[model samples]
Target: AENNRRKKLLRSAQKSIMLWDPDGPARKPPRESAELLVSADAMFGLSDSFQRCTSPDFLLHTIGGTTRGAIERAYDWLIPIISRLPDTISRLPPSTSCFLLLRAYGADGERRAQLKELSTPLLHHVQDSLRGTLGEAES
Candidate 1:
C-alpha cells in the first residue's frame, strides 16, 4: 500500500512537471529543475524517498564522484528536498522530527538558523520535547 502511494506521488510530480515544463529535465539548467521538483513536491506532497535522497551522505558517498552527470543529477534532487525539509520534518512523528532537527542543528549553524526561520509550530513542539528529554537523559 505504501509502495503504491509512493509510485503515485512520483507519477503526479512527473506529470505536473511535464505540463509545466516539457523540456525541463533535459534542457533547462539544474537549478530550474530543482525549482520544478520543489513545486512538484509541494503540489503533490513530499516523498519520503526523495527527502532521503537529499541527505549529505546520499549526495556525497552515493551520488558524488561518479561522473559529472551523476553529480548533476544529485544536485537536481538535492536543492528542492532541502528547501522543503522543514515541511517534511514537521510531518514526521515527534521523535524522528526532533532527531533530524537536532542533528542538523549540531552540524551547521546556517542549517540551524534555517530550521529556526522555516520551522512550523509542530516542529517547535518537537524541539521542546527534545529539550525536555535531553535534560531527563542527562540525570
Candidate 2:
C-alpha cells in the first residue's frame, strides 16, 4: 500500500522533471527550479526508502513487502539507475564513482544473503509444521 503510493509519486515527479527545460537560453543562474526540486525530492525519497527498508525493525518485521523475492526485483530495477546516479550527478569521474556503487552492491548482496539465511529457514519450518499438523488432522 505505502510502496504503491511512493512508486506513483516517484513516477509523477520524474515526469515533471522531464517537463522542465534548464538549458533554454533565456534561463538565468537560479535555473530550472521544477527540475531541481524534482531531483532533490527524488534523492530524498531514495534515501528514505533505503533507510526504511534496511533498518533493524524492518529486517525483523519484513515490512514494505520486501520479501527476498521482492528485494531481488528491486535490485534488478535499481542497479542500473543506482550505477548511473553518481555519473548523472557529475561530482566525480565515472571510474571513481564505479567503486562506490560496486562497494554498495557488494555490501547489499552480503546483507541480503544474511537475511535469506534466516527468512528461508523460518519459512520452511512454518510450512513443514503446517503439513505435519494437517497430517495429524486426518488421522
Candidate 3:
C-alpha cells in the first residue's frame, strides 16, 4: 500500500508541476502571492522525494514536469529548488533523465549553462545506450 500511495503522490506532484498555467485566469505571478507561496512549499516538499524515487521513469517524468514549469515561468514556485538540480543530477545514474535534462539545457543558453555542463555524463550514457538501436544519428 505504501508503494501505491507513493505513486499517487508522485502523479499528483507531476500534474501540479506540469499543469500550472502562468497565463491562467488568476495564476499570474507576484500579484497571486498566496497561491504561489503554497505552490513553492509543495514544490520544495516534493523535491525531497523526487531524489528518493528508484524508478527511472518517475524521475524522468518529475524532472520533465519541473523543467516544463520553469520554462513556462513558474519561477515564483520553482526558483528555490532550481539551484539544487545540479546536485540531484550528479547523484542519479545516467538514463532517461538525460533526455529531459537535455531539453531543459537547450531552452536558455545563458541561464542553463550548468545543466548543459552537468548533462555531459548522461549524454554519453544515453549515446551508448542507444548506439545501435537507431544508428549514429544523435537525434
Each model's number of backbone clashes? 0, 0, 0
Residue 18, candidate 1: C-alpha displacement in angstroms: 22
Worst 10 residues of 3 by lDDT: 74-83
lDDT of 3 by residue, 9-35 (tens): 555544453335557743333324434
Please list all clashing residue pairs in model 1, or write none if there are none.
Answer: none
Tell me model 2's lDDT, rounded to 2 decimals: 0.40
Per-residue error (Å), model 1, residue 14: 18
Model 1 poorest ten-residue lDDT run: 88-97
lDDT (Cα, 0-100) at 99 in candidate 2: 30
Model 3 / residue 23 / CA error / Å: 24
lDDT winner between 2 and 3, please give it.
3
lDDT for 85 in candidate 3 is 52
* Model 1: residue 79 alpha-carbon error in angstroms: 8.9
C-alpha positional error of residue 126 in candidate 1 after TM-score superposition, expressed in Å: 1.8
Task: Write down the RMSD of all candidates, one decimal each.
Answer: 13.4, 17.0, 11.4
Model 2 reaches what TM-score against the true structure? 0.20
